[model samples]
Target: MAPVSDYVKIDKNPSLQVTADHRIEVVEAPIEKPGSGKVLVHIKTTGICGSDIHFWKSGNIGELKVLGNCILGHEAAGEVVEVGADVTKLKVGDRVAVEPQLPCGKCFLCMQGDYNLCQDVEFSSVYPYDGTMQRYKVHDERFLHKLPDSMTYAQGALVEPVSVAYHGVERSSVTLGKPAMVAGAGPIGLCTLALAKAMGATPLLITDISAKRLEFAKKFVPEVLTYQIDTTKTNQENAVAIRKIFGDSEYVQPPSVLECTGVESSINTAAYVVRRSGVLTVIGVGRGDINNFPFMHLSLAEIDVKFINRYHDSWPACINLIANKVINVDSLVTHRFPLEDADKAMATSSDPSNGNIKVVIED
Candidate 1:
C-alpha cells in the first residue's frame, strides 16, 4: 500500500545520548494511516510555552526526560484532516482544540474524574512523546475538542493556557467581591487577571517589572493596578509598594494571591501580601527548588498555600467560556510565527525582557 502523506521525524539516539547535543531536524517519514478511534488533524495555530523552552534547552523537565529528538509544541488548534474508520464523534474539516494530554481512561484518578493526575498519561511536548510542531497530528478521538463557530483558530490555541488559569482559580476558590493580587504579568498571569474579573472580583491588581507587558495588560485590563518594579530597588522597596496598594492598615488584608511569575521574590510577595486565612495559589514553575519564601509570613498570617501542576479537565469548559465570550483571549497574543521559526520563537519566549505577551507558531 502507498502512503498518502509524509511526516517529519526527529532522530533519536537510543544509546550514549546524554552528551549528544540534541537538535530538531526535519525529515519525511511514512505517515501512519489512522486506525480505530483516531483522528488526523492539520494544526492551524500552536503556541510555544515555557515547558517547550525547557525541553529545547535542557531536554528534561521534572520527571519527564527527553530521550530523543522530538517535535515541540502542545498548545494548538487544528482542522480535522481525516478520521479513522471507527471514529464517529468528529468528522473531517472540524475545527478543534487539541487537549494534548491524554490520560489512561481506566486509571484510578480518571475513574474519580481527576485525569490530570493519571499515572500513565501521554502529554505532548514531554520527553519521549512527539509534539504538534509538524504539519499534521493524529490524536485520540476523545482528546479532540470541536471549537464553536465563533472561536478562531488562534483563540483555540489560547485555550490551553486559559485552562491553566481556570485550574489556578479553582485551587483558590476565590471569594467573590474580595480583593486579589496577581504577581506575574506573563501570559498565565494576565490570563488569571482576566479570569478573576470574569468571576466578579473587583479590578484584580497585577504587577510585573516589565513595562512592555504591563502596557499589554493595560490595553484590556484597565482596572488592573500595575507596578513597574525597578529591579534595582531592593526587595524591601518592592514589598513596600505592594503593601501600599493593598494598604496594611486601611484596606482588608490581601485575601487572594496568584503568583504566576515563578520567581522567588514573587512568592514572597504573595505570602506577605495575603491576609489572615488568605489563599495563595502558586501557579508558576520556578527554575528549580530555588524559590525562597518567607515562611514566617505564611505562618503568622495563617495563609493557606497550594500549587498547581499541569491543568486537566478544563478544555471543554474553557472553550465554552471563550465561545460564549466570557473572556477575551484573542487580544492576549502579541506575536505569531510559523512552525519553521520554532527555534526563534523558543528563543524569544526565553527572554522575559522581550515584552512579548504570547507568541503563537502557526503550522
Candidate 2:
C-alpha cells in the first residue's frame, strides 16, 4: 500500500448536506484518505432515503436531530479509489455498495449476527457521522460489498434499502405460496413486494395512501395487487376493507404482513388484517409512541410483531437478487441529478407531485 501522503486528493469534494431545517446545500470540502482497514470510495451514485428527507426537511426524525450541517445520504454505490493497509478483500477499481451501518464488532449483538441492533452502532447520514453524499467516502472494509458486473451503480446503491426489505421478509418468514401483504408502497415497501415475489409469495398485495405510488407499484410489479388506502377512514374500517378485498372468509387472511409505513393507522390496519398466529414485521421508521394500537386484538389473535432496525446479513442476498434480475431495480430509479444539483434531487424526491419512486444523485 502506498503511504497516506501519496494518495490522490481532489481539491474540492462536493457534498450534499442538510445545513439546517428545510435546507440542503452542496458544500465543497477537502477529500479524505482511508484509515487502516478502510477504503476510500469515489461515490458514483447515492439514493435519497426517507430518513435523509426527514432530516433535511425538519432537521430530525423523532429524537435524532441534526446538530449541524450533516451530510445526507446512506444508500450509496461507488468505486474504490484508495485502499488502506490490511484491506484484503477490496482493492482500487472495485465497484462496491456501501452498507452504512457501522456496528461495534465486539458487541454481543454483532457476535450473534444481529449487529443492526448494536447499541454503539454509528449509521451514515445520522447526526455526528458523515454519509456517502460526498464525492469521496472512507468506509470500513467490512461494510463495503463489491458489486457484480451485471449491476449498475444505481442498482448497487439500492442494495442497502433492499437489504432492509430482505431483513423484514426474513423476519416475516415469507415463503412460497404464502399470502403476503406490504402496508406501504414507499421505497422499502416496494422492495419488500419485489422480494416477496422473488420468494414465490402468491397473491401478493401492497397498500399506500398515495394513489400515485400505488399506480407506480402496479406498473412496476404487475403480478402484485395494489390498493390505495382511504385516509378518511379509521384504521379498523380500513382493515375491514382490506379483508374484504382479500376475500378473507372466516378462515383466510394474509399471514405475513410487512408494515413499511410507520404511521399509526397503517400499523394498526396491518395488525388487524394479519391472520392469527401470523407475523407482522414493522420496517418503517416513524413515531416511537403509537396511539390506540390494537394491543388486545393482536394478543387475542396471537400475531407475532417484529421490528427491523436496519439490516444484518442481508447485503449478499440483495446483491444476488439485483444481479440475477430477481428484483429489477431499473424501474425503481425515476429521477437522477448530478452531485452538483443534489439539492434539486432532494427536492424532487420530497415532492409528491413529481411522482418519483426513487431519486438518485450521480457523480
Candidate 3:
C-alpha cells in the first residue's frame, strides 16, 4: 500500500460543485481522509446522470432540493490510491465502481436484503451527503465493487445505471419469451432494453419523443422496434397508436412494461398497453404527485405497478453482464469531458437537442 501523500498532491481537492441552479463551478475543498474500513479513491470517470441534470438545471428533483453548495455526481468509477486501516478487500492500484448509496446495516430493510429501502441510507449528491464529483473521494469498502481488469472506467461508471436497469427488469419479472415494452430511449431505458433482451424478452418495443434517441436505440439494439411518440396526441391516443403498432389483437398487450420516461403521459400509456396481470415497473423518477393516473383501469386489469428507488444487491450481476459481453455499454458513452469543463458537460447533458446519450467526465 502506498502512503496518502504519494497519491494526493495536496490537502485540497478540486471538485465540480453546483453552487446554484443552472450553474456549476470548479472549487477546491479539503480532501477527506479514509477512516477504518474505508478506501480513498482517485475518481477517473463520472457519468452525468439524469438526476444530475435535474439538479444542475433546477437544483431540485421534485421535492428533493439542493440546499447549498453541493457536489453533483454519483455514477463514478475510480482507482484505489490509498487504503484505510483494516481494509483487506481492496488495496492500492485496484480499480473499483463506487456504489453511492450507503445503507445502515442495522436497519430492518438491510437485514431483509432490501438495503435500498433502509431509512438511514445516505445517497450521494442527494441533499446532505456530498457526491463523487471531486478528484479524491473516500468511500466505505463494502459499497465499492472491484472492477475487472478489462473494464474501462466508463464501463465502471455505467455499473450504477446498469444495476438500476437490472433492478427494474428483475422487478418486472421479464421472462425469456415474454414481450416487453420500454417507454424511454434514454441511457437507463436503453440499458433496460439490453438487459431485457439478455434476460430473454423478445420483440422489445421502445418509444421516445426524440428522433435522435430513437435512432441511437435502433443502432444500439437493431432487433428491437423503436417509435417516435407524438407529443401532440393525447395519452389515450398515444396508447392506441402503440397498440396499433403491435397490431390489433385480443392478446396485443405486452407482459412487461417498463416506464422510464417519468412523465405522466408515458405512465398512462404504459398502464394502457400492459397486459392484464402483467407487471408495469416505473424506473424513472418523476414528480411526487402524479395526476390523471388511470387507477380504475389498473385495478380492473390487476396490473402490478411496482416502483424502484435505486438498486439493491445488483452490482455483481451488472459487472458480470458487462464483463461477459451480455450487454455492450461502451457505445452508450457518446461524449467525454475533463473535470475542468464540468459546466459544459452538464449543459450538454441537459440539452436533448444535442443528441447526447451519456456524457462522461474524465479526470
> Ten residues in a row with the worst lDDT in model 2?
1-10
Best by TM-score: 3
Candidate 2 lDDT tens digits, 1-363: 533324655567999888755678889856777878988888999999999988987788877889987888999999888889888998888899999989999988899989998988899999888998999988998999989898899999999889989888888868798688999998999999999998999888999989889989998899888778888898888888888877847355788899998998899989988888888999999976899989999999889999988889888888998898878988889999999999989889999788888999998
- Candidate 1 global lDDT: 0.77
- Model 3 lDDT vs. the true structure? 0.88
Off by over 4 Å in 1: 1-30, 233-237
- On the 0 to 100 scale, the lDDT of residue 278 in model 2 is 89
Q: Backbone clashes in each candidate structure, one number apiece?
A: 1, 0, 0
Q: How well is each residue in 278-356 modelled by candidate 1, as lDDT tens digits? A: 7999998766665456777678767899998878789999998899988898877878776666666666777877677
User: Number of clashing pairs, model 1?
Assistant: 1
lDDT for 111 in candidate 1 is 95
Per-residue lDDT of model 3, residues 263-285, tens digit only: 88899988988888888999998
Worst 10 residues of 1 by lDDT: 11-20
Candidate 3: TM-score? 0.96
How would the candidate models be sorted by TM-score, starting from the highest?
3, 2, 1
